[model samples]
Structure formats: C-alpha cells, structure tokens
Target: MNSHQPDLRAAVRRLGRRHFLTLTAAAAALAFATDLPAARAASVPELDARKIAENPFTLGVASGDPLPESVLLWTRLAPRPLEPDSGLPDKRVVVTWELAHDETFLRIVRGGTATAHPEFDHTLHVEVTGLDPGRPYYYRFRTGTWESPTGRTRTAPAPGTATSRLKLAAVACQAYHHGYFTPYKHLAGEDLDVVFHLGDYLYEYAVDSAGGSRAYTDRVLPAHFNREAMTLADYRLRYALYKSDPDLIAAHAAHPFAVTWDDHETENNYAGDTPENSVPPEEFLLRRAGAYRAYWENQPLRAPQQPKGPDMRLYRRLQFGQLAQFDILDTRQYRSEQAHGDGWQKARPEAEAPSRTITGETQERWLLDGWKDSSATWNVVPQQVTFAQRRDKPTADFKLSMDAWDGYPASRQRILDGAEAAGIKNLMVLDGDAHVGYGFDLKKDFQDPASRTIGTEISTTSVASGRDGADKPANWDDLTQANPHLKYYNGRRGYTVITLGTDRARVDFKTVSGVTKPGGTLTTAASFVTEAGRPGLTPA
Candidate 1:
C-alpha cells in the first residue's frame, strides 16, 4: 500500500456522504439476503454430509471493478473442478466474507454473507462499500470451516481530486495450452492498481484444434480441455481449468482487474450475431449467451454487468481521482462481421462505407460522449484489437487485417475527430490481442505521417500465446520501416506496464525471455514516454 495516508474525512467529502450511505445500504442488503450455512445444516443433512472435504478455493480469490467507495470481491466454490458439475451437490451454499484494514483479520471493518447458487456455477461476488478511498483493503471468503486466500485490492481515489499518479498493467491473450503463466507471476509482484485484461482471458477451442504459432510446451491441460467449449457446462469447466493456474491466481489476488472479452472467449473472430464457424444465427446466439453467462460468473464485475440473454453492457468508465480515467470498451459484442470473413482484405468502397461500424452506434455515441465530458488529466481507452493501422506489404497497395480497427476506417475517423473536437489532448489507447507488442503514435491519418498525432497507443503482447516466439518474425523489419509511427515491436511473450504521472505517461514493454518453460526472466525490452500535452511516443 502507498503509505501516504491522505485525510479520511477530506476523502469522504470528495466521495459524497450521500453516495457513501447508499453504498452502505447496498452492502447491508447483500448481507441480509443469505441465511447462514450453519443455520440450514439441520434441514439439509444429506447435503451437509457431502460437504467439501478438500479445499474449495483451488480456483483462488480475486477482486475487481474498484470505485471510490465500493469494490467487488470474487471466489468460486470448486472442490473437484475437473468434474462435470464441479463435484458438488446441486444446492445453494452460503459463503461468508470479510474486508479488513490489514492482512490479519484482527482489525476487520466489514463482513457479510452471500449465497453461491449452483445455477451460477457456485461463484460469489460481494459488492462492498463505505471504505476510505485511495487505500488498500484485504479481503477473503469462507464457506463453513474452509477459507479462501486473502486478496489485496486498492480502491480508486476520490473522483474529482487531483491525485499525483496511477500505475497499471495491460495484459491479454493467455492461451493455457501454449505455455506457462510465468509473466503473470512477475506481474503479481509489480506495484499496480489494476490489470486491464484486454481480452482472450481463456480460449474456447480445443488445445490442438486452436492452431496457434506453436504447440503446447509448458504442460498438458486436463482431458476435459481437449474439446471446444460449446455449452454452459463446457464454459464453466474451461474457466475452472484456467483459474486453477497458480500464477494467474497470484496476479488476481495481488490486484483488482478490469477486463473485457475478445473473440476467443466465445468463438474465434465472432462478430455481433455472426460466429466464425458457419453455425446458424439461432444456434450461435445460444452459444454466445452461454459463454456470456460463464464469463460473468467468473469475473468480479458488479450486478449491472450481468448478462440478460445474449446482451450484456460491458463498456463503462472508471475514474482515478483527477489524474486518470479509463473507458473500457467491448469491441467483440456489437461489431459488424469481419470484412472478407477474417483475413487481409483490400480497402474497398464497401469496407469504407459509413454504415460499417466496429463499435455499434450506441457504444460509439457513449464513447464520444465520455470524451466530451471527461475532466481527468489523462484519458485512456482500454480496448481489444489493434487501434493503429499496420500495412503488411511494402508495395503501394495497402494490405491490413480486416478484423482490426483498420477494417472500419470511418468509425475510427469519427473517434479521432471526436477526441480532437473535444480537445482531449492526453488521450492514450491501450489494447491487446495480436500476440505481439506494438508501441506507436496514433496518427490522425495512418496513411499520412504528416497528419496530426492525436494520441499514443501501447498494445501489449500475450501472456503466453505464441510459444517461445521468434525475435524477428517474417517481414518484421519491412513492416516497421514502412510504418514509421511504430516505435517498437517484439514477438516475445510479455505484458506492458503503464505509469501515469501528472506531466508524463511512461510505458514499459516488459517481456519474458521464454514462456514454454517455467521461471523465465523478466526484462524491459523498450520504454516510451508521452508528455502531457504532446501525444507522440519518445524513447525514455
């Protein structure tokens, strides 16, 4: 925890007292909803006898979606995770939780009870509030005599105050079958407020069928993961398998997370109502709904983000005092189908049509409105897909990925224009999903370098997607030289760390030497800084 203890009374004033009261009421209601597990034991003797003998916290504990006055704590009850139904009797279980000022529970502040219903994969999310802002809190959950791991989470600073700095790590695309989560173990030790998982939290396809750059080298996945995740039970089992990773659990316990999904969470390169495979629209929707429900059950998101059928509103804003504000966007949900069905496509007339949208009209309006109204010093857009334009060939003809922002030129232009019109000078865009690191300046017109530099974009690589990736991939030099705005590129596995100061924002491209094996070393491959007013990347 940062030791600079600001005045709690002043912090309360910044976080309005009325809002504090409302949060207290919400927490109380969550506590009142569940009856004690011991109280129900006598009535359900059979279920009690089959009580979890082994540790149900194998998947570990996580905390996320922090606010000035509230935060969410999450844990799933899984005694035998590899089993079909998590090896538990089909019954609702009462779970107890506590938030404290210190790691030890001696100085407890708030405690509550929640029901982990089997309908929701026995996952629990407790929304807690009325704590002092910009400070660390320790939280843990308990079911009967079994207890979860203690997780450390920090709340956001009071909304409108001028905090000095904010630290965050951007991570994505961890394919469990490819390699080990060694990078996440390194991330767990960093001093960070949050980990923005840009997407691909867990891949949905089979280990062998999901053709990546390389084969599985770290370890063999459980037998259940050999198949694709199609049903609700399959999705739940996949999440359990990923959560069982120790390094990933460590990262979750170390800090709160704000996450959004990419295509692989459900199916490869899926658009709004269209799946990558040629499944019928009706059947694909059912699969999508199942994936969405499983994602919600595992993450630490609040009730508002819960899915209603196939529709779930995930784009939202998180503020860190007056220093920084993050607008987390969901690009996979309401996007138009990939041009030419997911490959390099010529920039044609239809591709540039105004009707073609990557972010649906509603989300586009919401993002533009957020830019227009945001008052923070540094505004960040944490989203999936590469925001910059990358040309694959060196010829006069432009070739780019139809699945990325390049495919929707008109929509991208609108966002850049909105930022410029709203006078958002310190705009920063962070993304993941390429399985490669990209450091570049966001040009108003990607094709023309003479155009204005509107912002800086730092796209982090995968945690472990391309196993032991080559340092110099095919056409790497040609592509970097062709696109002069691209400051740095790395094919190795890693995540990017961003440190936001009042005057400047520094981005460190942290890479692990290897991920195919355990205990790889961490190294800073490159570092770039963007000054407060200037929106271009400079080698730091």
Candidate 2:
C-alpha cells in the first residue's frame, strides 16, 4: 500500500463524518414528519384558557441534558402557585410543543404532544429528539390556548466529533430571605451554551410573607412558605416560589441547565439518611423522599433520573463533543457523616479512615472509570463542595471544613490517585455552596508547597446567599498568607462564567455590587485560567 494513499483515506474518513453530522437533523426531521401523526391518538379532557382562573405557565420554561440528538424540556402548570394543588382540579392536561430553527417557528422541525398528569404536579418533560450537532433551536409549550415563553436550547456536538469552544455558567446558593436573585438577570443576557447548578438550588428555610429581605411591598407570600420545607407539598410549593422569580425564570429560558444537589436541597449538612438535627433515620428518609420527588418534578431531568424512594442516581456524565466531559455528582446523598460535628475542625483521625467516602464507593469507582478513556480535552466535575483543601491556619494545626472534601481526605486521595492512574489531563472541578468565589490549585498534598498539582478547582459565589459582601473579609490577609495554592478569592454574590477551548479553560468571576434590593451592576471581580495540559491556575 502506498503511504500517500493512507493519508488520502484518512482525509476522506474525516469528510464522511462531517457529512453525517450535517445531515442528521434534516434527515431526522423528515423521518419524524412522515412517521407520526400530528394529532393525539387518545381523547382527553379539554382545558379552556377562559375557564382557568390564571395563566398556567407562571413558572416559565426550561431545558436540560443537551445530547447530540435530544434535549429535555421542562415546565409546570400552576395558576395559583402557592396553593397545595396549584389551584388545578386533579386531572391530566395535554401540552403541545413545537421546536423550530427560527425564533418565529415558521419552519418547525419537530412537534409533539405530552400529557401532564396530576400525579406529577402537572409538570411536563418533553424529551425532544432529532436535532443537528451543536445547533441552536427555539421551543415552546402550548395548552388550551395558553403559550409558554419561548426557550432557546442547543445540543452537544455529535459524538467523537471535535468542537471549538464551550461556554458555561456555574451558579448556586440562593437564599430568598437573604436578598434578591439579581445575578440571574445578568446571566440570562449573557451568551452561553449551558449552566451548571452545582447545588443549594433552594434553601430549606422559612420565608416571611413579604419575601424575606426582598420585602415585597406590592405583594404578600403565602403563609405556607413561612416554615421550612418538610412535606412533599411543602417542597413543591418552595420550588414554585423560587421559580416565580422573573430573573430566575429568564435565566432558565435562555440556556440549558445541568443540575446536581447538595445538602440544603434536603437538609443542611445531611449525609445520606443522617439528618443534621436529632431526627430518626426512618423519619428523615421520608423527608428525603419528598425533597427528591419535588426536585425531579421541577427540574428538566429524564425518567431515569427520577428518584426511587430516597435513592437517586444523579451521578452521571455529560459530554460536549470532544471538548469537555462533565461528571455531575451527588455528594450529599452517599457520603460518610461529617467528622467533628460537620464544622471547621482540626485534622481528625476519623476523617482519614479508609472507609470514609464522600462520593460513595460505587460512585467513586464510576467516576474513575469514566476518565480511563476520556476523549474530551477537559475532564470536568460539577460537584457540591470544594475539592481542594481550604485550611484556616497555614500550620499543621489548621482547621478544615468538615462539610467539604477536606473532611474526606481519604476519598480525595483515591480520586486524585485514580486520575493519575487513568492518565487524565486537564482535570477541572467546579464547586458551589461556598458563598464566595475561589480559585485554587488542587494538590496531592496540601501541607507540602512543592506537592504535585493534581488539577484546578473553581468555587463560584452565591446568587444571594451571603447578602452584600465586601471585596475582602477581615481575615483576607491571613487566608492569602496561609494557603499558597489559593490563587484567587472574592467575597461577593454572583456566579462564574467558564470559557473552555482546546488550549485552555478560563473562569471569570462575575459578581454584582449588591443583592439586597435589586438591579446590581455585574462586573468581573477576578479572572483565572488553566492550561489544557498543565493543571495549576494562573491569573488571566
């Protein structure tokens, strides 16, 4: 065989791949149009808009899990949102969805009908399929002449295909009583591909009728929201209240979001069935079931992600062509109870026990195995807490957050060792729940300044949890002087925008001046970038 002939064959194979991806959407569209009938096969009860007291699409629309050929679209029907039953009679409703290449939807590629059962709180999950690789599409839902706001979503690049750039926003920690969610308004306007909500989607706290620090002078919240979420109905109502925010609704409508939960989703600092308070294991599991059930109903997740009792397999992988692979983990569900009562404590022997695991043993194995043959340029982990060691004092007697990865040093060691064994490159861990933006160089040994750099971790600040924070806390100098691996830090309320490319990944800490009232000006508090091959963070 001629050597030049082999080169020509390689070029032809590349061209063939491009051809397939280009035709995937158009071909699927034609096949769907010819295969299925447009009308619903079975008859259902009709829901007239005039009969219903209010607009059903009050929570707005959202899409998630952007696969190459399909995406999960979500919306709930709630006319009177705060009511336990959402003011709807116990009945099923049919929702029609349309997806098009243009905003006007003149050239719709896919259209379908989905039933919203009262069993699932009238929530709709339309897994629209047959789409081109990395292509943008506009979609909306319709029921009884009521139309939901149009949402824009894009699919990932075709499998094994090389992509140029991917933009993402990491967000978390919203406390309604603390302040308003101003960050989301700015986030909705940004040009981004996806959003990663690491955790703390809603705080299990009480909100007064006036809406906490928001102090809504125009309206009053329902009395039901005045207590922490405990029952399934309470949890569902909490989601409705959070989703009612226009800024948050707009953010979800703008981009697809991939989510994973932390402690606050169920209970503060909860580890599996173990509750933070002195609650019975069996009783606490019941609360967990409620939280998980409500979480699945509200989010744009598929059937497989739904909870079975208190167990939910939320640890899964999402890929963006050959550019990045995100391993979304559930650290709060399958973790060892935090040592030293789950607070900042001196290094303890119990945390170093080999049996101690934060990702659980099964999930740890899965995460390590996924990295073995990863074709993506960046192996990312969108998880709950900080992956790097955050010590209060520089000395050996320093204290670490037991609620974070520092309390699971043995588990952290296993993950780091596994990455090294798998020959993984460009390891990036995205974190939420810190209430402050942080950039750190993940090291094999935090005690040693010359230790090998394992990866880079960026912990994004809260949307409204910490209230209006200062640029530097009182212990800023002490913290900077202590942890040498800590490259950047910002005490504010905002999110992090990550721009990933083949060569490097850059994270811009986007902060707002304040969140107490509303309309805080967004600004970049700091910027950091890590090279593709190298694992340490550097100021960009």
Best by TM-score: 2
Candidate 2 residue-wise lDDT, 1-540, digit = tens? 000001222332444434423334323322232221123324334455456667899999999989999999999999888778887875667888999999999999999998776667889888888788898999999888689999999899888888889999999999887888999999999999999998989988999988888874476988989999986777888999999989999999999999999888888999976899997565566577668878998999987997755667898889989999999998988899999888999987988898999999899999999999788899999999988888886666778899899999999999999998998878999998889888999887888989988899999999999898878876677778889999988888999999999999999999999998887899999888899999999889
Misplaced by over 4 Å in model 1 are: 1-50, 208-222
TM-score of each: 0.90, 0.91
lDDT scores in order? 0.83, 0.84
In terms of lDDT, the best-performing candidate is: 2
Give candidate 2 misplaced runs (Cα > 4 Å). 1-50
Q: Once model 2 is optimally superposed onto the true structure by TM-score, how far is the C-alpha of residue 83 displaced, in angstroms?
A: 1.8
lDDT of 1 by residue, 1-84 (tens): 111111223333444445423434322322232233344545642335236788888899999989998899999988888777
